[model samples]
Target chain A: MVISRILQKTGFYFLIILVLLFTLFPFVQMLSTSLKHQYDWGNPSLIPQKLNWSSYSELLGFQKKEVKVPESIHRLLNNPKLSAEKRQKILDRFTSTSDVFPFINYFINTLLIAGTAAAISLLFAVFGAYSFSRVRYRGRSGIQRGVLLTYMFGGVLLMVPLYQISVQVGLANTSTGSILTLVVIYVVQTLPVSLYMLGNYFRSIPESLEEAAQIDGCSRFKTIFLIIVPLSLPMLVTVYIYAFMIAWNEYLFASVFLKNFNEFYTLPIGLKSLFVSKNAIWDRIMAASILTALPVVFVFMTFEKHLIGGLTEGGVKE
Target chain B: MVSHPGSLAQQEARFGWKTVAPSLLLIALLIVYPVAYNLYLSFFEVKLSGQNEFVGFNNYIDLLADRAFYDSLTVTVIYVVGSTLGTTLLGLGVASLMNHKFPLRGLVRGLVLLPYIAPLISEVFAWQFIFDPVNGIYNHMTVEVLGISDERVNLIGTPGNALLVVIIFDIWKNFPFAYLMILSRLQSINNDLYEAATLDGANRWQRFWNITLPELRFVVGAIVMLRFIWNINKFDEVFLLAPNVKTLPIYTYFTAFTGTIEQGLAAAIAVVQFLLLIGLIFLYIRRVLKW
Candidate 1:
C-alpha cells in the first residue's frame, strides 16, 4: 500500500512537471527564436546554435543616426530668436534619423499609451476602491453593481461609434485619444475586481484600529491615508501591476482604433505588424515579441504573492 | 466612525460620488456615450465620407440576410461553447489534483498560472508557430512520434480544424484562471464534512459528488455564467489566432473598420454583440445575486 501510494504521488508530481513545461515551453522557444542569428530561421532547432543581439540592437535604433533637437525645445520655452535655417536644420536632423527595425516609433508609442493609461487608471481605481471599502452609503450596493455590470459593455460593441467620435473630435489618428479611451474602458472594466480585492483586504483590517485613529481626532480621510494605505500597500501595488499588465497586453481596441496611425501602434500591434511587415524577419519579429512581453512577465514574477492573494480572493471572478 | 448619523449619511453619499466621480464621468463619456451613439448609428444608413440618413432597422435586416453574419454567429457560439467546456473540465481536474496535500503543491500551483499571465499576442503567436504547417513542433511531434504521416497538416489553414485549434489554444491559455478560482474555494471547504462522509463508508467518488459538488455548486454556477459571458464576447483569442474564421467580433471588425468598411452594418453587428453581452450579464446577476 505504501509503495503504491508513493508511486501515485510520484506520478502526480511528474505530471505536474510536464504541465509546467507545457506552460513555459512556448516562452522558452520564443526566447530561443529571438536569440538566433538573422539568417537562422531555417535551422529549426529548439536551442539556438549561435546567439545574436542584432535584432534587439536594430529595434532600439542602434543603427540609426541620432536626432539632435535644438537645446531650446529641451528648455522650458521655444526660442523664436533662432534662425529659420537652424530650425530647418533641427527638423532635418529629426527627419534624417533612420531606424533599422522601422517599428521603433511604434515601441515608444506603445510605452506611452500603456504606461500613461496604466498609471492614471491605477491612481483613480486605488482611491475609488479605498472609499468603497471604508465608507458607508445608501447607494453603495447600486454603485458596485453598476461598476461591475459596465464590463458587460464589451469594447467591440463600441468600436464603430468610438471611431466616429474619434474622427469628430479630431482624435482619429492619434495615440493619446486611443490611450485615454482605453484608460476609460480598462478603469471601468477592472474597477469591480480591484474593488472586490481591496474591500476584502480592508475588511480583514481590524476596525478597532480605525476607531482609535478617530478618537485621536484624525479625519476619516486622513486616517485612511495614514493607516489603511500603509497596511494595504502590497495589494495596492498588486492592483496597479494587474491593471498595467491588462493595459499593456490589450489588443482588440488598439488594433481597431489606432489603425491609421503607424506611429501610434502599441506593442501588441507592433507584434502583429511583425507578422505582416514586408521585411518580416521571423527572428527579429520573435525578438520584438519577447521585448514586448518582458514587462508583464517581470511584473507577474515579482508580484506573484500579492497577485495570488488578489486573484484567488476574487480579482478574477470570471 | 463619525458620530452624527443623519448628517453623516448625507456626507457619506457625497463622499461616495466624490470618490467614484472620476471613474463614473469617464465611463459616462466613453462607454455610455459610445453605446448610445452606436445604438443610434445602427438605426441609420451611415457611410464613410457621406451624409447619414435615417434607415430604421434596414442595417439589421441586411445583416440578418447576409450569409456571413449567420456563419459568424455559429462560429462565435462554437468557439465560446468549446473553450468554456474545455477550460471548466480542465480546471476541475487540476483543482482536484491540487486538493490533495502533496509536496511542492504551492510551487506547482504558482507555476500553473504562467499561462494566465503571459501576453496574449506572444502566446498566441507561439501557438501559431506550434501549429504551423512546415516546421511547427506539433506537426513534427505527431508525424515523428505518433507515426501519423499526413503531408503537411495545416491545423490552422483548414476551416474545421482552424476553429478547433483556436478553441484548444484558448482552453490551454485560460484553464488556469478557472483552476485558481476552484482551488481557492476548495481550500476553504471544512474537512469535518469529509470526515463524516468517510466514516459513513463513503468512497472518494461518493464524497466528491455528495459533499464537494454540493459545496462548490454556487462557485461553479457563478464561474460558468461568468466564463460563458466572457468567452462569448471574446475577440482577442479568436481574432488573433484565426482571423479568417470570422467570429462575431472579428466579422464586426472587418465590416466596420478593415475590409468592406460597411459602417452601418458593423454598427448593427456591434449592437447585436452588446445585447447578447448584456443578456448574459443579466443572467449572471440573477444567478450570483441570489447569494
Candidate 2:
C-alpha cells in the first residue's frame, strides 16, 4: 500500500513537470536566443555563452550603439555631391528618425490606438450590457441575439467591403484617417463579445441592488456607472483585456488599411515589416518579439487576481 | 417620479434604446453594411478605376471551376476539424491535470496560459525559429535529443507538412481558452456526486467516465463548435507563421488583396464562407449553447 501510494505521487508529479516543461520551453528558447551573441546563433544550448543585453537595450531605446549598416546605405552615403538634406535623410536611416525598425514608435502607436479603442468599447458595453441585462424593452432579446450573430461573422467577409468603405469616406490614405478607421473597426470587432461578457456578468448581479440604488435617488444612467460598473469590476477588466487584445493583435484589416502609412504602423504590421526587412538578425527579431509581448503579459499578470474563471463562464476566446 | 404603469414601462424601454444606440449604430455601419456590401460586390467585377461592371454569377462560376478553391476547401475542413479537436482534447486534459493538487499548481496554471496570452507576432517568430531547419529546437529534439532522426526536419517548408505544423501551432496557441471554460465548470461540479460514486464501488476511471464526461459535454460541445467557427476565419495565425499554407482566409486574402486583385471572385468566396458560417453559428447557438 505504501509503495502504491508513492508510485501514484511520482506519476502525478511527472505529469505536472512534463506539462510545465512543454509550456515553458519555447519561451525559454526565445529568451535564450534573444540574449545570444551573433556567434552563439549556431549553439543549441539554452544559455548564451555570455549574456548580451544590447538587443533589449537598443529595442527599448535606452542605448544607441552604432551597429553596422547595410551596404546599400553605405553606397548611397559615399556620393560626394549628395545634397545636405538628402545626405542627412540617408544618415537618418541608422537613427530612430528613419524607417529602420522603429520599435518605440510602433509600440507607442499600438498602445495609444488599441488602448483608446478598448476603453471606448468597455465604457459603451457597460451601458449596453446594463440595458441588455436589467432593463425590460421590446426587441431587447433580438438585439442580444443579433450581437452574437455579428460576432460570428467571419472577418474575411468584411475586409474587402470595409476597405472600400474606408476609402470612400476618405479614411484610408492619411495616418489619422487610418487610425480612426482602425479604431472604428476594432470597436466593431470587439464590441459584441465585450457586451456579451459584461451582459452575462451584469445579469448575475442581483436586481435588488439596483432597486436599492434607484430608491436612493440615483438615475438609471448614473446607477450603472456608479453602482453596476463598480460591482462587475473583474468582469469589466476581463472585457477590457479581451477588447484590447483583439485590437492589439489584429492584423488582417490593419494590413489593408495601413499599407501606405508607414509612420503609423501597428506592431503586427511593423513586426512583419521587420521580418521582411531584417531576416538575418535572430537577436533583434526575438528581442522585438519579447518587447511587443511584454506589455500585454505585464497587464495580464498584474490583474491576475481577477482571473476568476467564473467571470468568463461561457465567454470563448477573443 | 413614480408614474402610471404604461408610462414607466415606456420610459424604461426608451432608456434601453438610448443606452444601446451607440453599439447598434456602430454595428449597423461596420458589420451590417459591410455584410450587405460584400454580397452586393459579389455580383460585380470591381475594378481599380471605380467602374464595377456587373458580373452576376460568373465570379462564382470561376471560383467553383478553379482547382485551388477546392484544394483550399479541403485543407480548411481538415485544418478546422483537426485544430478544433486537438484544442478541445488538450484543453480538457490540461484542465483535468491542474484540477488536482500539486506543488506550485497556480504557477503552473499561469505558465500554461503563457502560450495563449503571448502576442501572435512574438509567438509566431518563436515558432518560426523553432521550425527553422538548421538551428531549431525541433530539429535538435528530433535529431539529437530523441534520436528520432539524423537529418534536420523542415516542418513548414512544404505544403503538406505546413498544414500539420500550422494546426499544431494553433492547438498550442488556443487550448488555454477551452481549458479556462472547462475548468470553471469542472470546479463547480458537486463533490457529492464523486463521493457517492466512490461509495458505490466505482473505480476512478469509471467514475470519471460516467460523471465528469457527461457533465462537460455541453461546455465541450460549445467550445468545439466555437473553435470551428473561429478557426475557419483565422488568418494571421497561419499567415504570419507559415504563409504557404493556404487556408480559406489566406486564399481569399491572396485573391482580394494581392495577386490579380480579383475582388469579385474573392467577394463571392467570402460570401459562401459567410453563409456556411451563419449556418454553423445558428446551429451552435441553438443546439450547443441552446440560446
Candidate 3:
C-alpha cells in the first residue's frame, strides 16, 4: 500500500509537470525567438545561442539614431513661433526611419480605441445595470431578456451587413469611424454581461441601505452614485476589464472595417499584416507578438481572480 | 397624496428609460439592424459598389449546391466535435488530477490559464512559427530528433494536415476554458459522497463513475455546448493560423470580401450558419443553462 501510494504521488506530479510544459512551451518559444538574431531563426536549441535586442529596439522604434539638424534648421526648431506644419515637418525629418517596425502608431491607436471604448461601455452599462436591478419599470424584464439574446448573437454573424452599412454610411476606412463603430459594437456586446453581473451584484446589496438613503432625502441618482457605486467598485472593475479585453483582442471586425486603414489597425490586425507581409521577418514578428500579448497577460495576472470570477459566475450560479 | 405617489412612479419609470436608452439605441443600431439587413441581403445580389438586385433564393440554392460549402461544413463539424470532445476529456482528466493534494497546485492552476488568456494573435503566431516547415521546432523534432520522417512536412501549408493542426491548436488554446469550468464545479462536490462510496468498498474508477461523472454532468454539458457554439463560429484562430483551413466563417469572409466578392452568397452562408447557431444556442440555453 505504501509503495503504491508513493507511485501514485510520483505519477501525479509527472502529469502536472507535463501539463505545465504543454501550456507554457509555446510562450517560452515566443520569448526565446523574440530574442534571437535573424540568422538564429531556424536554431533547434530552445535557448538562443546569443541574445539579441535588435528585434525589440527595431519594433519600439529605438534603433533609429536621431537625425542631426543643420545649424540653420536648428534655430527654427527652438522657435516656439514656428507654424504647426513647419514644426511637424522638422520633427518628421528628425524622426522618420523606414527600418522601424510600423507598429507604434497601431499600438497607440489600439490603446486609444480599446481604452475609450471600455470606459464608455462601462459608463453606459452602469446606468443600464442600475435601472434593470433597482428600478421597477414596465418592459424591464423584456428588455433584459432582449439584451441577453443579443449577447449570444455575437457580432461575427453581422460582419457582412455591418461592413456594407459602414460603407454606405461613409464610416469606412477612417480612424474615427472605426473607433466609433467599435465603441458601439463593444457597448452592445459587453452591456449584457455587464448588466447581468452588475445587476446581480447590486441585488446582493441590502435594499434597506438604499431606502435609508432615500429617507434621508437623497434623490434617486444621488442614492445610486453615493450608495451603490462605491459598494460595487469591484464589479465595475471586472466589467471594465472584460470589456477592455474584448475590444483589445477583437480581430474580425477590426480586420474587415480597418482593412484599408493601416493607421487605425489594432495589434491583432497589425500582427496579422506582419505575418502576410512580403519578406516576413520571424524575429521581429515574434517580438511584436510578445509585445502585443504582454499588456493583456499583465492585466490578466493582476486581475486574475476578478477575470475568472466574471467568467465563471454565470456558470457557477444555481 | 394619491397624485404625489403617481407622479413618483412616473418619474421612476422615466428615469429607467433614460438610463437604458443609450445602450438600447446602440444595440438596436449595431446588432438588430445588421441582423435584419443580413437577412435581407441573403435574398439579393450585392456588389462592392452598393448595388443590390433581388435574386430571391438563388444565393441559397447556389450555396447549397456549391462543393466548397459542403467541404467547409464537413470540416466545421469535424473540427467542432474533435475540439469539444478533446478539450472536455482532457479537461476532465486534468481536473481530476488537480483535485488531488499537491504542492504548488495554485500556481499550476493559474499558469495553465495562460494559453486561454494570452492574446490570440500572439499565441496563434507562436504556433505558426512552431509548425513552420523549414524553421519550426515541430519539423525539427519530427525529422531530426524523432526520425519519424526524413522530409519536413508543411503542417499549415497543406490542407488536410492544416485542418488537423487547426484542431490541435483549438484544443490547446481552449481546453483551459473547459478545465476552468470543470475544476470550479469539481471543488464544490461533497467529500462525504466520496467517503461513502469508499466505505462501500468501491474502487476509484467505480467511485468516479458513480460520484464524479454524475456530479459534473451539468457543467460538462454547459462547457461542451458553449464550446460548440464558439468553435463553430471561430474565425480568427483558423484564419490566422492557416487560412487554407476553410471553416464556415472564414469561407464566408473570403466569399464576401475576396475573390469574386459574392456578398449575396456570403450572406446566405452566414444566414444558414446563424440558423444553425440559433439551434445550438437554444439547446445551450434550455438544456445547459435551464433558463
Candidate 4:
C-alpha cells in the first residue's frame, strides 16, 4: 500500500509538470525567439546562443536608419498591370519610413482605444446595471432578457454589416474611426455582461444603506455615487479589466476596419502585418508579439484572483 | 387631481429610463441596428460601390449549394466539437488534479491561466513559429530528435495538418478557461459527501463517477455550451494561425472582403450562422444555463 501510494504521488507530479510545460512552452519559445539573432532562426535549441536586442531596438524604432522595403511590396508596386494611381497609393501608405515598424504607435493606439472604451463602458454599464437591479421600471424584465439575448450572439456575425456601416459613416481606415468604432463596439459588447455582473453585485449590497442615504436627503443618483460606487469598486475594477482585455485583444474587427490604414493599426494588426509582409523578420515579429502580450500577461498575473473571480462570478450566476 | 396608480413609482420608472437611455441607444445602434441591417442586406446583392440589387434568397440558395460552404460547415462542426470536448475534459482532469493538496499549487494554478489570458495574436504567432516547417521546434524535434520523419512537415501550411494544428491550438489555448471554471466549482463541493462515499467503501473512481461528475454536470454543461458558441464564430485564431483552415467566419470574411467581395453572400452566411447560434442559445438557456 505504501509503495502504491508513492507511485501515485510520483505520477501526479509528473502529470502536473507535463501540464505546466504544455501551458507555458509557447511563451517560453516566444521569449527565447525574440531574444535570438537572425542567424539563430533555424537553431534547434530553445535558448538563444547569443542574446540579441537588435530585434527589439529595430521594432521599437530605436534604430536610427530606416529599414529597406520588403521585395514583395516593391514587386507589387512594379507590377505593370497595376494602375499608377493604385501604385502611388500603396507607396504613400506602406512605404513611409515610420510605417515600416510602427510598433510604438500601435501600442499607444491599443492603450488609448482600450482604455477609453473600458472607462466609457464601465460608466454606461454601472448606470444601466443600477437601473436593472435597484430601480423599479417598466419593461425592466423584457429589457433584461434582451441584454441576455445580445450576449448570446457572437460579434463575428456582425462583421459584414459593421464593415459596411463603418464605410458609410466614414469610420473606416483612420485612427479616429478605428478608435470610435472600437469604443462603440466594446461598449455594446461588454455592457451586457458587465450589466449582468454589476447588477448581481448591486443587488447583493443591502438596500438599508441606500434607504438610510435617501432618508438623509440624498437623491437616488447621489446614493449610488456616494454609497454604491464606493462599495463596488472592486467589482468595477474587475469589469474594467475584463473590458480592457477584450478591447486590447480584439483582432478581427481591428483587422477588418483598419486594414487600409497602417498608422491606425493596433498591436495585433501590426504583428500580423509583419508576418504577412515578404522578407519577414522573425526576430522582430517575435519581439513585437511578446511586447503586445506583455501588458495583458502582467495584468493577469497581478490581478489574477480578481480577474478569475469576476469571470466565474459572471459565468456561475448566468 | 386624480392620481393614477402610484405616482412615486411612475417617477422612479421615468428616472430609470433616463439613466438607462444612453446604454440602450448605444446597444441599439451598434448591435440591434447592425443585426437588422445584416438581415436586410442578406437578401440583396451588394456591390463594392455601395449599390444593392434585390436578389430574393439567391445568396442563401447559392450558399447552400456552394461546395466551399459545405466544406466550411464540416470543418466548423469538427473544430467546435473537438475544441469544446477537448477543453472541457482537459479542464476537468486538471481541475481534479489540482484539487488535491500539493506544494507550489498556488503558483502552478496561477501559471496555468497564461495561455487563455495572453493576447491571442502573441500566442498564435508563437504557435505559428513553433510549427514553421523550416525553423520551427516542432519540425526540428520530429525530424532530428525523434527521427519520426525523414523530411520536415509543414504543419500549418497544409490544409489537413493545419486543421489539426488549429484544433490542438484551440484546445491548448482554451482549456485554461474550462480549468478555471471547473476548479472554482470543484473547490465549493462539500467534502462531507466525499467522506461519506469513502466510509461507504467506494473506490476513488466510483466515488468520482457518483459524486464529482454529478456535481460538475451543470458547470461542465455551461462551459461546453459557451465554448461551442464562441468556437463556432471563432475567426481570429484560425485566421491568424492558418488562413487555409477556412472555418465559417473565415470563409465569410474572404468571400465578403478578399476574394469575391460578395457582401450579400457573406451576409447570408452570417444570417445562417446567426440562426444556428440562436438555436444553440435556446438550448444553452433552456437546458444548460437554465437562465
Candidate 5:
C-alpha cells in the first residue's frame, strides 16, 4: 500500500508539472516575442539576444520624427532651452524605420476609462448590495432577476446602440464618455452577482450582532455604516478587483466605441494595431499585450482565494 | 417586525428606493432605452445614412425570405448545443479528476482558467496562428510526427468544418468556468455523506450517482442556462475565428456596417437576439430557482 501511494504521488506531481508548463509556455513566448524586432523570428534561445525597446519607444511616441516632443517630457529631461541638444541624441539612439504607435495616449485613455468605471461600479454595487442584504422590500427577488437579465445579452448585443449613442452625442472618441458608458453597463451587469455575494456574507454574520445594534437605538443606516461595512471589507475588495478586471480587459465595446481616433485608443485596441501588417509586429504586440495583462494577472494571483470564494458562494447550497 | 408606526415603514421604503435609485436609473437609461429603441427601429425600413420610412413588418418579412438568415439560425443552434455539451462534459470530467487529493492541485486548477482569462483579442490572434496552414503547430504535429501526411486541412476555411472548429475553440475557451462552478460544489460536498454511504455498503459509483448528482443539479442547471445565453449572443469568437459562417450577431453587424448600412434590418436582428436572451433568462430563473 505504501509503495502504491508513493507511485501515485509521483504520477500526480508529473501531471501537474506538465500542466503548468503548458500554461506558462505561451506567456513566455509572448514576452520573448514582444522584446524582439518586428521582423525578427527563428531565435533558438528562449531569451532575445538584443534588448529591443523600439516597440516601447514607438508606442510611447519616442521615435516620432514628424511630431515635436511634448513640453512635459522635454522639461523632465532637464533641457528647458528648447534646443535640439538632448532631443536629437535620444531620437538618434531610439528611432527606427517604423512609425511611432502613440502608446502613451493609449495607456492614459485606458486608465481613465477602466479606472472610472471600476470606481462607479464599486460604489453602486456596495450601496445596492447593502440594501438587498438588509432590507426586505416588495418584489426584491424579482428586481434581482431583472438586474441579471440586463447582463443576458452581455456586451456585444448592446454594441449597436452604444455605438449609435456615442456617435450621436459626440462621446464616441472621448475617454470620459466611453468610461461613463462602460460604467453604466458594468454596474448593471455586476450588481446582481455582487449583491448576491454581499447578501450571503451578510447572512453568515450572526443576526444577534445587528439586533444588538438595533437595541442600542442606532438607526438602520448607522447600523449598516458602523457594523456591516466594517465586517464586509474583504468581500468589498474582492468585488472591486473583479469589477476592475472585467472593465480593464473588456475589448468588444472599446473596439466599436473608440473608432479610428488612435489617439484615444485603449491597450486592447493598441495591442491589435500591433498586428496590422504582414511582416508581423511580434515584439510590439507582445509588449503591449503583456503590459495590458500584467496588472489584472497580478491582482488575480494575489487575491484568487477571495475571488473564488465570491464566485462559488451561490453554487454550493447548504 | 414592524416595531415602528406606519410612517417608519414608508420611510424605510423610501430609503430602499433611494439606495437603489442610482443603479435603477442607469439600468433604465442604458438598458431600457437601447432595447426599446432597437425594438422600435426593427419595424422600420431605415438605413444608417439617415434615410427611410416606417414600413411595418417589411423588415421582418424580408428576414423570413432571406436564405442566409435561415442558414445562420441553423448554424447558431448547432454551435450553441455543441459548445455547451462539450464544455459541460469536459468541465465535469476535469472537476471530478481534480476533486481527489493530488500534487500541485491548486496550480493545476488555476492554470486551466488561462483560456477564459486571457485577453480575447490577443487569444484569438494566437488561435489564428495556431491554425495557420503554413506555420500552425496543429498541422505540423499531425503531418510530421503522426505520419498522417493527409492533405493540409484548412479547418477554418472549409465550409462544413469551419463552424465545427470554431465551436470546439469556444468550448476550449469557456469550459474552465464550468469547472470552477462544479469544483466549488464538489468541495462543498460533506465527506460525512460519503462515510455514511460506505457504512451502508454503497460503492463509489452508487454514492456518486445518489448523493453527488442530486446535490449538483441546481448548479449544473445554472451553468447550462448561463453558458447557453452567452454562447448564443457570442459574436467575437465566431466573427474572428470563422468570419465566413455568419452567425446571427455577425449577420447583424455585417448588415449594418459591412453591407448597405441597413440599420433597420440590423436593429431587427438585434431585437430578436435581445428578446431571445430575455426569454432564456426567464427560463433560467424558472428552472434553477424552482429547486
Candidate 6:
C-alpha cells in the first residue's frame, strides 16, 4: 500500500511537469532564438552560446547605428560642397527605417489605436449598460436582444459589406481616413462584449445605493457617474482590458483597410510584413514578437484575477 | 403611452432611449446595416470602378460549382472539428489535473493560461519556427534524435500537413479558454457528491465517470459549440501560420482582395456562412447555453 501511494504521487507530478513543458516550451524557444546569434542556431542546445542583445537594441532604436544609408546615396554624402553639419543633416534625413521594420512607430500606432478604441467602447458601454440595467424603457428587452444577436454573427461575414462602406465613403483612399475606418470597425467588434460585461456588472450593483442618491435630488446621469461608475471601477478596468486586447490582436480588417497605408500598419500587420520581407531575420522577428507581446502580457498578469473574475462571471451566468 | 413626455415614467423612459441611442445607432449602422447590405451585394456583379451590375444568384450558382469552394469546405469542417474537440478534451484533462492539490498550484494555474492570453501573432510565429524544416526542433527530433525518419519533413510547406498543423495551433492557442470555462465550472461542482461516491467504495475513475463527467457536460457542450462558431469564421490564426491552409475565410479573403477580385462571389460566400452561423447561434443559445 505504501509503495502504491508513492508510485501514484510520482505519476501525478510527472504528468504535471509534462503539462507545464507543453504549455511553455514554445515561449522558451522564442526567447532562446531571439537571444541567439546566427551561428548559435546550428547547435542543438536550447540556450545560446552567447546571450546577444543586438537584435533587441536594433529593433528598439537603441543600437546607435542610427539607420542604414542606402548605397546609392554614398556620392551625395561625399560631395565637397556639403559642410560637415550639412552632410550630417543630410545623412539623418536620408537614413532609411523601412528596411528595419520601424518597430517603435508601429508600436505607437497600435497603442494609440487600441487605447482609443477601448476607451471609446468602454465609455459607450457604461452609458448603454446603465440604461439597460436601471432605466425603464420601451423596446428595452427587444433592443437588448438585438444587441446580443449582433454578437452572434462572425466577423468575416461583415467584412465585405463593411469594406464596401469604407470604400463608398472614400475612407479607403487616404491614410487618416483608413485609420478612422479601422477604429470604427474595432469599436463595433469590441462594443458587444463591453456592453455585455458592463451591463452584467451594472445589474449587480444594489439599487438601494442609487435610489438613496436619487432621493437626495441626484439625477439619473449624475447617479450613474457618482454611484455606479465608482462602484464598478474594477469591472470597468476589466472591460477595458477585454476590449483593448481584441483591437490589439485584430488583423483581418487591419489588413483590408490599412494595407495601402503602410505607415499606419499596426503591430500585427507590421510583424507579418516583416516575416514576408526579403530579409527575414529570425532573431529580429522573434525579438519583435517578444517586444509586441510584452505589454499585453504584463497588463494581463497584473490584472489576471480581476479580468478572469469578470470574464467567468459573465460566462457562468450565461 | 410611454412615448408621452408629460408623465414622469415616460420622461424617464425617454431619458433611457436618449442615453442608449448612440450605442444602438452604432450597432444598427455597423452590424445590422452591413448584414443586409452584404446580402444585397451578393446578387450583383461588383466592379472595381464602383459599378454594380445586378446578376441575381449567378454568384451563388458559380460558388456552388467552384472546386476550390468544395475543397475549402472539407478543410474547414476538418479544421473546426479537430480544433473544437482537441481544445475541449485537452481543457477537460488540464482542468481536472489542476483541480487536484499540488505544490505551486497558484503559479502553475497562472502559467497554464499563457497560451490563451499571448498575442496571436507572436504565437503564430513561434509555431512556424518550431516546425520550420531547415532549423526547427521538429525535424531535429524526428530525423536525428529519434531516427524515426531519415527525411526532414516540411510540414507547413504542404497544404494537407499545413491544415493539420493549423488545427494543432488552434488547439494549443485556444485550449486555455476552454480550460478557463471548464475549470470554473469544475470548481463549483459540490465536493460532497465525490465524498459520497468514495465512501460507497467506488474507485477514482468510476466516481469521476459518474459525477464529474455529468457535471461538466453542459459547460463542455457550450465550449465545443462556441469554439465551432469561432473556428468556422477564423481568419488570421489559419492565415498567418499557413496561408495555403485555404480555410473558408482565407478563401473568401483571396477571392475578394487578391487574384481576380471577385467581391460578389465573396459576398455570396459570406451570406452562406452568415446563414449557417445564425443557425448554429440559435441552436447554441437555445440548447447548449440554456444553463
Rank all candidate structures by their DockQ, best first, as comma-separated numbers.
Answer: 2, 6, 4, 3, 1, 5
Docking class of 1: medium
How do these models rank on TM-score, best leading?
6, 2, 4, 3, 1, 5
- The sequence of per-residue lDDT tens digits that candidate 2 reaches over residues A1-318 is 999999999998888888778777778878989999989876888899999999889778887767677889888889888998998876766664343468999999999989999999888888888889999999999999988877567789899999877777778868889889899889888888888888888888988988898999999988887888788888888888878987888888889988999889999999899888834478988999899888888888877766545234544444
Local accuracy of candidate 6 as per-residue lDDT tens digits, A1-318: 999999999999999899899989888888888999988774667889999999899989888555667776788878888899988877767674446668999999999999999899889999999889888878999888888776556778888999999899988999999899889878878887888788888999999999999999999889989999999999999999888888898899899989988889999999999999985988888999999999999999999999888656542110
TM-score of each: 0.87, 0.93, 0.91, 0.92, 0.83, 0.94
Residue A256: error of model 3 in Å?
1.1
Candidate of highest DockQ? 2
Off by over 4 Å in 2: A67-99, A308-311, A315-317, B1-5, B144-147, B280-291
Per-candidate DockQ vs. reference: 0.52, 0.73, 0.59, 0.63, 0.36, 0.67
Instruction: Tell me how candidate 5 scores on lDDT.
Output: 0.71
Error of 2 at B76 (Å): 0.5
All candidates' lDDT scores? 0.77, 0.86, 0.84, 0.86, 0.71, 0.87
In Å, residue A38's CA in model 5 sits off its true spot by 7.1
Task: Write model 6 residue lDDT over B1-291, tens digit each, in one string.
Answer: 557656988788899998888898898899899989999999999998988999989999999999989998889889988999999999999999999998899999999889888888998888888898887899999899999999998999999999999988888888888888889999999999989999999999998899999999888887887788788888989999999999888888999999889899999998887777778668777876774
TM-score of 6: 0.94
Worst 10-residue lDDT window for candidate 3 chain A reads A309-318
Whose TM-score is greatest here? 6
Give candidate 1 regions above 4 Å deviation: A37-45, A60-99, A102-107, A173-179, A182-184, B1-5, B278-291
Model 3: per-residue Cα lDDT over A1-318, one tens digit each: 999999988888889999999999999999999999877889988788899998788788887755776888878878999988998888787677654557788899888888888888888888888899889889999999998776455455789898889889888757678668766766666667777888888888998999999999999889989999999998888888887887788888888877777767889998888788773788888899899989989988898888888777751110
State iRMS for model 6. Answer: 1.8
Considering TM-score, which of the candidate structures 2 and 6 is the better prediction for this target? 6
lDDT of 5 at A249: 62
Interface RMSD of each: 2.2, 1.4, 2.4, 1.8, 3.5, 1.8
Please give the C-alpha DockQ score of model 4: 0.63
Estimate the lDDT of model 3.
0.84
The prediction achieving the highest lDDT against the true structure is 6
Task: Please give the lDDT score at residue A71 for candidate 3.
Answer: 86
Angstrom error at residue B155, model 4:
1.0
